[model samples]
Target chain A: MKKYLYIIKTTFNDSIQYISSLFIRFIGFAITMSILLSLWTFIYQDNTTISGYTLKEMFWYLLLTETITFGSKSPVATNEVKNCIKSGNIAYQINKPYHYIIYSITKYFADTLIRFIAFTIISTILGLIYVGPINNISIISFISCIPVFLLAVLITGMIKILISLTSFWVEDSQPFQMIYSKIILIFGIFFPIEMFPKIIGNILRYTPIYSVSYGPAKLMLSYNFSFFLNILITQIITIIIISIIINIVYRRGVRKLNVNGG
Target chain B: MLTEVKNNLKIMFLSLKYNLIRVMENRVSFLTSVSMMIFNNASFIIQWLTIFTLVEYIGSYTLNDIMLFWAISSGSYGLANILFNGANKIPEYIENGKLDAYLVMPKNVLCHVITSSTEPSAWGDLIYGYIALIIFNFSIKNIFLYSLLIIIGALIYTSFVIICNSFTFYFIRFSETSEILKDIFINGSIYPDVIFNRAIKIIFFTLIPCALASWVPVHLIIEFNIYHFILLILATNILIIIAFFLFYQGLKRYTSSNLMEARS
Candidate 1:
């Protein structure tokens, strides 16, 4: 735990040096959100509500979704795992005090937290400027959303690690990364599952991506105690399942590495 | 000048051929990348679908018009990336002094640099673009016009990227800024032109020139106007000329990194 803390602290410090680049990324996100806002505003130029969401609500919803999608990016773990496998650096890490998986997760968490905070602040300011306050979000709901958002970040990190570990066999994990991100972008980040066709929405709810992206955003948009509980339970289950899969895959990959004299 | 043009075209074709063969060596990776790009692009259709579901048309653009918008945008993006991908990497090349190889080559340095690489996933975009066009208008005339428009759009897109990237020579560590500019141009191109106000519209036409890449081309395709077509061609050529001038002007200031590196 202490070692993990140290890793987090160091990663956080490292991220600060790239603050200008992060600001540039924030500008990119702002431009994207502004585009969405214009598109939605134009769509609602005629009528008031569409499928129970006001134009303001829709804008706010998009803001939250964009926040989750951009904020929870966990490239560090993916790259780290890929490099370790490619360069046989995993052999060196295997002898370290901390578990390799734990170290990777700590680094991912620290980097993601720095990005998430920066993005959230930027998005909020942009939202306030563009659409004003949402007016429906309660303080309680926002507070309750914190833990679930952290869990969502963790789930995303774990999934990235799993994808990265595939580099042990595959020549490149970039395609898998692209596909997974697209799924999240389409089904989870772009719209609430409820807005999807009923059957498709229900099916997506069963997938882990739902918990990773939509769960926290949905809670913040309009919180219900039962809804919160359900998503929380789903997130926990996903984390456990993915963790087990990672452990199995990492162990097998290490064994294969040994056989190959890596 | 004609001889130089013919020579550059020949070299560009050869570069593209070798790049294709290189990427195809990893068959699964290549196929996966292309398919994923297509799938990713397809997802945007759903967002528009949801919008149209709520309203029949937004700002004189029906669902069909929106589809045409995407077709042109994706098709132009594909054309630019497939043939001239190095525009995106100009900053890195300048920063690391990787342009030494191109400078030593006999061909036009800018043309050689841009054609030196190709993005396989852009083929997916090209395929998706044609699919959208077929779904919308499959006539022989439309096909011919689509080809011409894609060329015009690609030239503008490539020149815009080059112009953005040439800033690297003027300022140290401006790569991120270049990326942000490219992102804005791309994100702006994907949407309908009606969404932008007059000020932004002006910026899109002049500073970023994103309108030349997709929106103006889509308009020309939908309703053929010889005047607009002529204007578009003139603007694209002027932009390309400006890009070439800026690149060469910046080249004079470039100091080689003196680091030894090999190209595979």
Candidate 2:
């Protein structure tokens, strides 16, 4: 447990370095938020609400989506796997002491932290201007929900790595990575899976992405202990399944690899 | 001169063929781009349908007028994208030191970059635009006017994108400029010109000049505004001149850094 904590601390430091180095990226993100928030505010000015979401609720939802999105390792995880395979770095990884998956998980955490800070500052300012303070949720819920959100992030990361490992067989994994991440963003970040078609909704109900964004967003809004437990159980089960699949694919990819470094 | 024109046409066709072949060779990137287009067009149709359902009409233009506006906007988007996708990413090329490849190429550097990226997503918009045009059943006069408007509109936007992209040579961070340009062209141009009164309309026409991109052209086609018809020709020439000057200025500032260093 202490080792894991140390690993996390080190990773967090690395993420800070990354954010400082690529400072322009944060500025770009801030501008993107302003554009989106202003556009939503404009639309909301005409129609007070859409569905059940008030202008305030809509703003909060946007903030929530943008804030949590910084934590999405779904793309980076895939990119790491694809680059590793393409450059034959997977062989070097075999000799390393740390697990390859741990490296991806930690990097994602660091990336998310920087994104979260930028988002918090930007959203806080925009939210104040547009709709005022976010909903008054309980402190208990806020504190308790942290783990669930982290669990959600982990699930997203695992799923991305799983999709990325496909590149070990195929020459290029970008198409699969793009389609996978889009599915997660559109379904997970933008719209709740419940709003999707009945067939897709049912199929995705069992997926890890459900635990990542939808389940957490719902929990943040309305907390039912039973529903929370169900989400937690779902994430655990998905993680186990994905881990098994990764191990199988990793071995197969190792055999198929030409071991030629670019 | 005629033979030169024919040769240029042949080269353009060959370039298009080469572009398709290059994209096809990298199947993943092509598929991702096409999918992005599908997603974009789908969302656009849904959003427009929602807005149209709510509003009756603005100005003399009715729902059909708005649909024609939609079609023209969509067509301009596709045409400009096909023509100027490379110019769009000039900042990145300049910043990341990737512009060297184009600068060294014997043919026109701007042409190489502009033709380098063919967004499959714009193709979806192109199809949708034609559909919208046919559905609106524009009058003969309106059709002729709208066709001319579309050409001018594409030129205005193409020049704007080129000019914005050239700014990357001076400013290291230009993604913001492109983002702002996108907002102006994509979302800003959609509303009827009548939404703004005369003064604001004039500003949109002559200064920031978004109306030349869509609103003025579409409005003139339907309402037969003589001033705008004349303004379109003037706007086209001004935009072309601006683009040429900006590109020339940016090219002059460009230090011929080695390709390897540029990649870094």
Candidate 3:
């Protein structure tokens, strides 16, 4: 635990070096948010409600999705993981006392924490100014959602690590990364699962992708105690499953590397 | 001057040919990238579909009109990236002193640098754009008009990106600013112009100029407006001239990193 804490501390310190870049990226996010705000404003121009969301609710929904999608990006971890496998750099970490996966997870968590904090602040201000307060959100629900949001971040990191591991087989992991991101964008980030066709929405709820994005955002929008409990349980189960998969995959990959003398 | 232009075109052609061959060497990777881009581009249409299903029109744009808008936007972005892909890499090149090679070349450094690479996924955008046009309705006159608009739009997009990236010469690390500016321009181009207020519309026309990339072109196609067409042509030319002028002015400030590297 202490080792991981140290890793997180150092990673956070390193991330501070690129504060200007992060600020610029936040500006990019603000621009995207403005575009969506304008778009949804236009869409809601004729009707106050479409598919059970008011104009305000729709903007709030977009705000949550954008925040979650942008905040949890771990580009440094993604690049490191891909390069480690591609260039056989994993060998250097393989001999380390600490686990490479844990090290990577800590670095990713640090990066995500910094970005999420910055994005939350910016988005909150923007939301206040652009859409005003979301009346549906309960104070209790908002407080309870802290753990859920952290789990969502973890799930996101795990998924990225899994994608990056594909570099062992493929020459470039960028295409895989692109495809996965698009899938998330279409199904998870852009539109709420509720807006999906009934059958599709129901099926997506069963998948981990729902827990990663839609579940958290939906809870923030309109939280039900029972629904919140279900989301929490689902995310924990998914995290466990993904962790096991990562363990198996990483171990086998390392073995293959050893055999191939990579 | 004519002979010089001819030689530069030849160099560009060869560069594109070689880049294409190199990318195609990994057939699976190339195909995957192209297919993924197509899917990515197509997904945005779903958002529009969701909107139009609820409302008949958005700011005077019907579903068909919006489709035309996307076709022009994607086609123009694709052509710009395919022909002048390295414009996107200018900040990185300038930062790492990679422009040294282009400086040594006899060709126009700006043209040589921008035309040195081709993006494989842009082909997907180009194909998808035409597919959208076909869905709207295919006609000879429309095709001619679309082709001309796409060329002008490509010029605007490329020149805008080059000008933004050339800021690296003035600022030591302006990559982030360049990237954000380019993203804003591209994102602004994707939406209908009617959504923006008069002030933003003016800014989009003059400062960022995303309207030239998609909205104005789509407008002209939907209704032949010679005035808007002439305006777009003038804007594109002015942007190109500005891009060239800024690039040359910045060239004086470029202190090479002196890193030993070669362009493949």
Instruction: Give the 10-residue window scoring lowest on summed lDDT in candidate 3 chain A.
Output: A253-262
Q: What is the TM-score of chain A alone in each candidate?
A: 0.94, 0.81, 0.94
Model 2 per-residue lDDT tens digits across residues B1-264: 787667655655666667667667877666666665555544544444444544444446666777777777777877777655676777777777787887775555666666566656676566666667776754667666666677777778777788877888887677676666556556557666655556756766665577778887676766776876786788689888888788878888887556575321
As a whole number from 0 to 100, the lDDT of residue B160 in candidate 1 is 91
User: lDDT of candidate 1?
Assistant: 0.86
How far off is residue A116 in model 1, in Å? 0.8
- Residue pairs clashing, model 2: B97-B262
lDDT tens per residue, model 1, B151-171: 888899999989989989999
Give a tens-digit lDDT track for model 1, residues A1-262: 8889999999999988877778778878888888888888877787697777777877877887777668877678677789888888888898899999989999999988988888889988998999888767788888899899888888888898999999888878877888788778778876777778789888998998678877877777778999999999999999889999999999998888852462
Q: What would the TM-scores of all predictions be?
A: 0.94, 0.75, 0.94
Identify the superior model by DockQ, candidate 1 or candidate 2.
1
lDDT of 3 at B233: 89
lDDT of 3 by residue, A62-150 (tens): 78877777888878558889988887878888888899998898889998888887877888888998989888676798898888888
> What are the Cα lDDT values of the candidates?
0.86, 0.67, 0.85
